[model samples]
Target chain A: MSSERSARSRHRAILVLTGLGLAAAAILATLDHFTHEPIALERERRALAALTAVLPADSFDNELVTDFIEIGIDGLAMPARIYRARLAGQPVAAVYDVTTDRGYSGSIRLLAAIDPDATLIAVRVLEHRETPGLGDRIEVERSNWIRQFSGRSLDDPPRQRWAPDRRDGDFDTLSNATITAGAVIEAVRRNLEHFEVLGESVWSDPEDTEHD
Target chain B: MKPEHQDIWRQGLWQANPGLVQLLGLCPLLAVSTSTINGLALGLATIAVLVCSNAAVSVLRGQLRPEIRIPAFVIIIATTVTVVDLTLQAWFHDLSRALGIFVPLIVTNCTILARAEAFASRQPLVPAIHDGLAQGTGFAAVLIVLGASRELFGHGTLLADADRLFGPAAADWTIQLLPESWEMLLAILPPGAFIALGLLVALRQWLIGQTGALRARAGQSEAAA
Candidate 1:
């Protein structure tokens, strides 16, 4: 009831509050510390899995091609990275440095895989933000625009390849997704060439003595 | 206080669903609802974080200085989220990957933040935990329903990857409804998520209205008698 007692109560309230705040913060931080790696590793695992699905992780102990080459794109004015798919000192597949810069929407990054014999192994769209229903038909979940590139090859040996079905050729373009189809086809075309030209360096195992 | 707390649960389910009513988490809800399992996985993770953080905040509501409460709340949220995220990875690695950034991103989700700031900051620990559980369950319900709607129509079945979301026993829970060839191209896309959510919200509203009308009719009859 007195001033001194009221002041003491206020201080008690403040102390209790502070203790609670500190306790909550401590619990959260502990949780954060423990979960951080698994969350990150989970992301890495999924990304790695996607990559493995496209490029065989089991085949190459290297798990990567350090040499990053750039190739002038057919449809776009930009040059994208060229990666080689290697398996124990031999070129197993050509991982193209593929990009769809001129789609009906924004730029789309893709890795189109073609084996040493030049059969399409897989097409992985690295990035794209097309309309979810219409233009996003580019995604594997939507239209089959990607799978169409599976068996495609370049008769020109990495310089110029098969014409996109939309431009009146063999590969079929998405019914209403002509521009997307063309851009993907072009990225695939260039990607295969990067594999051919850079195959030896990209796919060959570093331990091999023949290069020296 | 009692009525307000009750409203919190009611609000999470119908009046203020995180996915449909508030439109907070359209990204993952659209990106991953290829199956019901994906929906259930995300919903459960969210519930875990919500209950933990909300309870922590409620317990500490009095001590946090007014000047530093926001940062304190965030630190708490991030921590609880981190723990839940880690637990998922260690125990449910496949699901942890499937939900991806959305789990950690739950730290930033407005639904959790709004509750921490509005309900947990002012309430006692017991009520706060109750609010958190109610809200979390509500949000999860919406996500699961939205997810199930898409998965069922998209794949011509429900619970396609039941084992992934609900363990191996649920593997047989998938209901094969349509002939495998019939795919509703519209139902599986992002637009489908929106359409599904819109229909879901409408369905919830209809159910709520029916319940309310029945209650009102009973009350009037009792008064007249």
Candidate 2:
């Protein structure tokens, strides 16, 4: 008799637990249904903002977010999105959205904008998992370390000198963030080289380029 | 002014602060307290989750059996945290990015679960809600204090990035205490978090000791008279 009573209570426990779990799931699903659209919209807005930050407002007349081409590039672990900047139907600059896996912690995504003449307009870190106080100096908000890339081109720093000064290169390394600094510098240089190779063709239709 | 409500406030705030006394949720407390804005953002998120989870658990306490109570609490807390995480992502994009994984990790913050088991699950709805506010405020207070001290010492400013939490109108809320170039890197590192929290815990202990001694002395004088 005691065994049967205990078995009934145990069965009731499982039923109660299942009921609570289902209720929680229902609530979560409802919230996700409502928030899904706004979350995507917010992500797109931030991405567009990052692109805008890398290029001067006066430099680009076209919508930077909508004006873009996707291509697979070397050095970048993933396919890259190159956003074309135009001023009154003429190409002003091309911004390469690239990701590098060489950061001290993990992947670091960045934007490198190159002018028509192959000179760098600016570079900005979009996302990174780097150590906060040490490697986060790569952010334009944290320090002006990334701003040093402005006006730099392949020939100015030369091909071999495109690295942190710690490695005997032309660029200065952030204090205690040598690896992260090196990764950003390397990614920027690689993107510039790719841009130079593409030349005026970078502004051409996506089908013409053999980047695939 | 009810005795039970007052007792709850006393325990949550001073006598049993999650940060200084219970030492609950130390992971988020120590990790995100590097800046005032970061700490404040995470603290607010934590408070929201705690209040919601406590209330839910209290309302359903009768159905929870000993065999399944723990799992039930976990589901409720996890669901509340996800809702908060999504809400932040949708509305407060910048602050959400600043907080990163810490916001979702609020589910693992033992303070929420501890309160559910210790106070909320057994209490009435009103007192359960009261306990939630008290405990959450206590935890947030410690975070703000720790964050301010760390930001002042490490970055040489207080509320240095207020705009992240309070929008662009608060861009100028930063108060620079030291020169921008004069930063003590150690103060913002993990080791600094440990040291600052240790000092805070020691300060609380010293204050309690002093108050106890004063009360004892007053009692002895009264007996003599």
Candidate 3:
């Protein structure tokens, strides 16, 4: 009789704990649903605000998001998303991240902006904390090391032909920040070539880029 | 608070620092510390949950029998963390999303349950609250320091999204250390996070050593006198 009583009590304890846990989750889910929308709105507002810093407000009338498959470019192979901003019914700029594995510390994230004509416009350091006075030279403000790629044409930077001035190429490397600069140079090169191939898809009707 | 009760509070901050000494909650600590704003935001959310859970456990401690206490504590922590997670989702939204599933994962944070088991289950309300505050504050401080260090070296600025934590008034707080063209690209990578955190740990150890030396010297002088 005593053993049976103890077993019964243990079962009751389990049942009580389970009920409480379920109740807690249900209450949380309800609260989550109620507050989800406003939080999403704030996020959209922040993202839009960030764009103004990269592209002039008047420069774009629409933002098209799409997943485009990118083939081999400067030895990189992968698919990436492209955000096409159209102005006055013509393609103006494509904003995307250019990832490269050559920073003095580790991987680097570079934001590349290109014109509709498939030419590079600006390359900005979106994320990185490379060593100061070394890999930090990737940002244009740190030095003019990146400006050399601004006006260079496709013919000037042939297939896999673009490299740091050290390897004998159109792009010059940053003083002491060579590996980081070299990685970025090739990243821009690959990005330009990748965009050239996807030009037609990007120039497709603006409504097509929005992904579900 | 009781005299012994105060010691529980102090222990959470030093002897059992959640982020550092205990190393209990680390997934969010590493993922969100990319920028100071992200680190500060998540840290605040974690602290809110800790305080609520600790108090709730204390309030209900008397009703729970010894054999069933652990289950009761787990259920209580889960409930509080879930509530806190949902609140942030509804109110802060972007932070909730950027933090993503990690917010919900707080239910599994060992520190929360550990505190409940060690202090809240046996202590009174006020002291339990103090323990949570001290622990949460220590966790937040470590996160903010990590975030700022990572942001400054990796992104060439401090508090890249200051407004995320404080409000729009904080938008102007972002510091411009180097020009847009010269910032290094490696500081934001995961490896840099590891290296930077390692350096921070080393710095902490050095500080501990200095403090220990000072205490020992004082002890010798007092004995001689």
Candidate 4:
């Protein structure tokens, strides 16, 4: 009789546990249903904000976020998205969203905007895993280190001089963060080189890649 | 408040602090306390989860059997944490991004599970809710203190990214304590968290010891009189 009672209690425990699991699932599903759209919108807003930060608002009449193309470059770890900015029908600049795995900790993602003349408009660090106090000076919010990239081009830095001064290059590196500074400088330099290769052809519609 | 409720507050806030006394949920405590704003954000999320989980556990205490109570509590806690995580992502998008994985990882904070199993599972709904609030505040206080200290010493500022947690109006809320060029790198690193926590724990212990000595002296004088 006791054994039978024990079996029944065990059965009841399983039922209750399962019921709790189901109830929790229902709550989560309801939350996700409501939050799904707002989350997507938030992400889009952040991405658009990053794009606009690099591309001057007055210089571009077109929607830079929608006007983007995907291209695989030698320096980037993965295929990069290049956003084209135009004043009316004329191309103003192209912003390359690039990633490099050469950071001290892990990956570093950046947005590099280059004018039609191949001169860098600006650069911003989107995401990075570098040490906070040491390497995070790359962030515009943290320091003015990244702003040094503006108005620079491959020819001006003379190709080889486009590196941290620690590595015998022209650009100044953040104190105690040479690796992070080097990774960002190299990524920007490679982006400019790739932009030079793509030239005015980069302004072509993203959907017309098959023709090339 | 009732005597029992006061007792719960005393235990949760001081006698049984999850951060200093019990030392529960130290993973998120250490990891996200790099900055004051990050700590505040995580602490708020933790408080939300803790209250909800405690309330649920207390409500279901009668129905939950001994054998399956652990699993039931886990489900309740996980669900509450996910709800918080999703809400943060939707509304407080920047704070959520700043917090990153630590927000979702609240399910494994251990303090929630400890409270659910030990106090909430045996207590009534009102007391359980009180316990949650008191304990959550205690933990958050520790986090803010640790974060502010680290930010001040490590990066030479307090609330450096106030806008991340408090929206754009707080963009200028950061207080620059030290000069921009000055930085104590070790304070921002992982080792700094351990040292700071140790000092806080020691401070609490010393205060307790002093109070105990004072109370004993007063008792002796009263007896003599």
Residue-by-residue lDDT tens digits, candidate 1, A122-172:
887766755434556777855666776666667633434355665766677
Candidate 4 global TM-score: 0.92
Q: What's candidate 2's DockQ score? A: 0.71
Residue A8 error, candidate 3, Å:
2.2
Question: What fraction of native interface contacts is shared by candidate 3?
Answer: 0.57
Report DockQ per prediction, comma-separated. Answer: 0.26, 0.71, 0.28, 0.77
Q: Is the docking of candidate 1 incorrect, acceptable, medium or high quality?
A: acceptable
Q: lDDT score of model 2?
A: 0.89
Q: Is the docking of candidate 3 incorrect, acceptable, medium or high quality?
A: acceptable
B46-78, model 2: which lDDT tens digit per residue?
989999999999999998888889999999999
**Which candidate wins on DockQ?**
4
The per-model lDDT (C-alpha) reads: 0.69, 0.89, 0.70, 0.88
User: What is the DockQ of the complex in model 3?
Assistant: 0.28
How displaced is residue A150 in candidate 2, in Å?
1.9
Per-residue alpha-carbon lDDT of candidate 2 for residues A46-111, written as tens digits (9 for 90 to 100): 888888898767777898888889877787877888999999989999999999999999999999
Best by TM-score: 4
Number of clashes recorded per candidate:
6, 0, 20, 0
Clashing pairs in 2: none
Worst 10 residues of 4 chain A by lDDT: A203-212
